[model samples]
Target: MKLQIDRIINEEKIEIDEVIDFSNVSMPVKIVEPVKIHLNFENLGKREVRVSGEILATLRLTCVVCLEEFDEKLKIEVDETYIPETFIENRKEERPIEELSEFTYKGSYLDTFEIVRDNILEFIPPYPKCPKCASKTEEI
Candidate 1:
């Protein structure tokens, strides 16, 4: 989702709670439901912002052992700081090492869809197992 920096700068903070559609996007796994996001964005001054939130979604995954399709619920927590693109150029030489790890926004907006998508992808289990198989393995 794309958020306007101007709004956060003007209001100092904003809260968002909505469902994001990703039907058109390409993903490694099937997303069976809309992504639900609940976030708070706070301006940290000097073109820096803090984003904190939770993302919820259901994904369709195939069990590695049984080869059956099953739904998996994902809950991802987000806590990130964002710096303006101009901040990098202005302080390229003086930028601290820690600052390099922070996320950057271009121009007047922050598009977090990619970040969210990546988080979702990372949350997937590499070797997924259906509930039945998972329980059986646990007893072994």
Candidate 2:
């Protein structure tokens, strides 16, 4: 998912298309979704730039009762930006998940993988349900 942005950074628009890894994520993130994040960077500035477009992926959810994997698709439209000020400064520097906040280009360039990955995660469902399936422990 390493996106080379050298060409896109210098231009008015750059298109990023690729699949990202979710295997290392927590339970739900690992269980559901085939992550593919797409980005189109534009609305450029000397020190700031915008990243926009869609995130598309397929999610397979297992029913609680039947325990069968069900198929679902996800597509999320994105509109976000990055500034040089907020980008990662050092690879060795450890950062909190929150400190990882703020969209910015690293090494004077945008890292497509990081930007797209963050945006896609924002669209992840907090609680996913299987339409035709029921929860094992029914709620009163």
| lDDT by candidate, in order shown | 0.87, 0.62
Alpha-carbon RMSD of each model: 2.5, 6.3
Clashing residue pairs found in predicted model 1: none
**lDDT of candidate 1 over 43-137, digit per residue (tens):** 99987999899999999999999999999999999888898877777774776776654788788887767767877987899999999999999
lDDT per residue for candidate 2 within 1-140, as digits (tens), equals 44344555567686767777666765444435457776787746555566787877666666555666676677778776666653455346776675443466566456665665666567666555666554434553
Tell me how candidate 2 scores on lDDT: 0.62
Q: Which candidate is the best by TM-score?
A: 1
When summed lDDT is taken over every stretch of 10 residues in candidate 1, the lowest stretch is 92-101
In candidate 2, stretches whose alpha carbon ends up further than 4 angstroms from where it belongs are 1-6, 20-28, 31-34, 62-69, 86-102, 133-140
TM-score, predicted candidate 2 vs. hidden true structure: 0.61
Model 1 lDDT, full chain set: 0.87
Instruction: Give the clashing pairs for model 2.
Output: none
